[model samples]
Target: MTSSARPRRRRRDRDRGTYSVETAVLAPVMISLLLLMVAFGRVVDAEGAVDAAARAAARAASLERDATSAESEAQSAAVRSLETEGVTCRTSSVVIDTGGYALDVGVDATVTATISCATPLSDIGLPGLPGSKTLTASWTSPIDTYRGRQ
Candidate 1:
């Protein structure tokens, strides 16, 4: 090849490798960011589900006459809600307190999710990133004092 053609060919070859190198360097970062976003979204969604479950449970608890049934109802609601959101609940608990004519309900949920960084150059592994989050919600409603009064 002529000197001019040689230089042109060299430049083209250099550029040809640059794209792949750039992609290799940037792909991981891009994938990590995407995984982070997905993890954050999962946390938010789980929290929302927990809140919804807590509210439902609290409403049920407020109408109940004892704390045992209230806790049972709350746990059931939370588990069902978490399942619907595709998140596993590592632990869940509900506490109900009654004083005078007031009822207070507290619900806690520990949520977990798996996030995958699906990129050609990503270093994150197949088990994906494991994330855990906790959410708590509480509600207080006045108990009916005269419901069974004569």
Candidate 2:
């Protein structure tokens, strides 16, 4: 019994450091995976924010009666929406299609708004990840057919 126990103890002692070595090798991989998930989550969040901003801008513009004011309102609405969502864009742009304003009052018209934003991800410093991602979203809202338009 003593002889058998002696060999078992020696084997256990030899394998003691294996866990440390495995952990040493796998720790970075686990950390990298975690960072990758974070980066992905940020991108998804940015996309959702952009989508909402576009929707808000289009809705705001559709409420306006003139092309000039519609564009102005759309731009402000887009900016406000992004800010409200806590998304910090490196560069942001809003494009408003006010062609619907030119249509007759009784016609079915729609206002389109496109929101573009550059989201920064280089701060994460994850390998193989892009330094920045550009996200764009467009939304169209129908104007009230019976409403007056200039």
Candidate 3:
């Protein structure tokens, strides 16, 4: 090889390893960001499911005359809705108050999710991470309307 060609060949060899180094530095950051996005999406989905369940339960309670049955129906609705959305419903609570001529329905749901990533650097250890999301929603409707008093 000519003397000038030798320098050009050496430069190409140096540049060849740079791409790998850059990829190594950037890959973990990208992966972590993607995982965060996925986690956030799951949280949002859980919240939406909980909200829908609470609405359904509240509607049922407004129509029904029995408070005990209304609460049970509310809890069941919340659990079933969350499970259908691929999130495990760890616990659920529902409260219905029929005092003051209005019925108030409240629901709280605890949901857990498992997220896995390709690299350990992006692995937010499942136990310590915020893997569970708690969502609550409440609805108030006039009970007297159903009873025909008002």
TM-score of each: 0.64, 0.95, 0.68
State the local distance difference test value for candidate 3. 0.54
lDDT of 2 by residue, 56-109 (tens): 999999999899999999999999999999998999899999998888879999
Instruction: Report backbone clashes per prediction.
Output: 0, 0, 0
Q: Mind giving the per-residue lDDT tens digits that candidate 1 earns over 1-150?
A: 587899998888878878888999999888878877766666677667666665665565556556555556655665565567665555566554534223222332222111211112122332356544556666555445543211
Cα lDDT listed for each candidate: 0.53, 0.95, 0.54
Order candidates by TM-score, high to low: 2, 3, 1
Arranged by lDDT, best first: 2, 3, 1
Clashes by residue pair, model 2: none
Better of 1 and 2 by TM-score: 2
lDDT (Cα, tens digit) per residue for candidate 3, span 32-134: 7877777766667766666666666566555555655555655566556556766555555666554432333233212212121111212344333464556
Q: Pick the candidate with the highest lDDT.
A: 2
RMSD of each: 8.6, 1.1, 8.3
Which stretches of model 1 miss by more than 4 angstroms? 1-7, 100-131
